[model samples]
Target: MLDDFDRVLAQARRGSPEAFQSLHGDLVRPVAAYLRNKGVTEIEDVTSDVFLAVFTGLGGFTGGQAAFRSWVFTIAHHRIADHWRREARAPALVELTLDDDGGTTPAAEHHALDALGTARVHELLDTLTPDQREVLLLRIVADLTLEQTAEVLGKPAGAVKSLQHRGLAALRKIVEPEGVSP
Candidate 1:
């Protein structure tokens, strides 16, 4: 599967619908979930916009899978920012649910504890500043490295690191109120 990297990218860049769908399969869930974390109301819509921008710009894109992933996420970040600018307010916290994009909850096999844990993560993330929240989500949620996260945020690596450190500390404070000293 990995060996077809060049073929997939070349075809997708050339406007091959099937290749685009193939790329979407790898990225859709994670990207939508990231937008949801950003409090994006129309997650699927924004996600589609992200992919559209990517496909349109693919002719100019260079590099392999890692670079492609970073570029797509950078587009996602920009789209979320645009959404906020239109709303004229920072993203607000919503009641985090354990529902999937299909708006369905997990089945009986999944524990209530798991759902609560998912809600707990969103709750904790909600406490951080927007910059910190974005950094944490880019790193932990999007699974981007520090460099990639920095690129997405248009911040220096040091700034990204600082935000991540502060974000983690804040989460620790909430999770372990007294045990860990500041």
Candidate 2:
């Protein structure tokens, strides 16, 4: 898969369904994870939207794998900003339901555990400034290189580096207040 990425990309640009599938298989999980890390509540929908943009725009795109990754994430970053803007103007709705006998169901318990799994990480992430949080998410969750992260954020590489440094320092302070880790 790695050796012939250019071929795959070329095929995808020409609208080959198999090439598209390969691209989607490779990127979907990372893209979804990045959105989830950034606290985008509609992960699946936003991920699909990002890929839709990628697929439609592939004919005009020019780059290697790293550049393609950056481009895809650039679209994702825009979608996240759009999602937040829309959310700010409208309130989200939640539906409530009761299980039989008013007790929690096993399915509910499974979901609760899943939510709890990331709750601590999210709580810690919530402490950083927005720029710091974004840099860290792009770097860690998306596994993007420094330059790629800068491209995704539309910032200079040096600026991205500074944010990443500061963000990591802040997390260190929170996790290791005594300036030590084991």
In candidate 1, position 117 carries an lDDT of 74
TM-score of each: 0.76, 0.87
Per-residue lDDT of model 1, residues 1-182, tens digit only: 24577899998877788898888888888899899888887887889899889888989999988888889899998999888786776555677765556665568658777768778778888999999999999898788889989888889999999999999988888878646454
Q: C-alpha displacement of 145 in model 2, angstroms? A: 0.5
On the 0 to 100 scale, the lDDT of residue 68 in model 1 is 81
**Distance from true position, residue 119, model 2, in Å?**
1.8
Q: What stretches of model 1 exceed 4 Å from their correct place? A: 1-3, 87-119, 177-182
Could you tally the backbone clashes for each prediction? 0, 0
Give the total clashing residue pairs for model 1.
Answer: 0
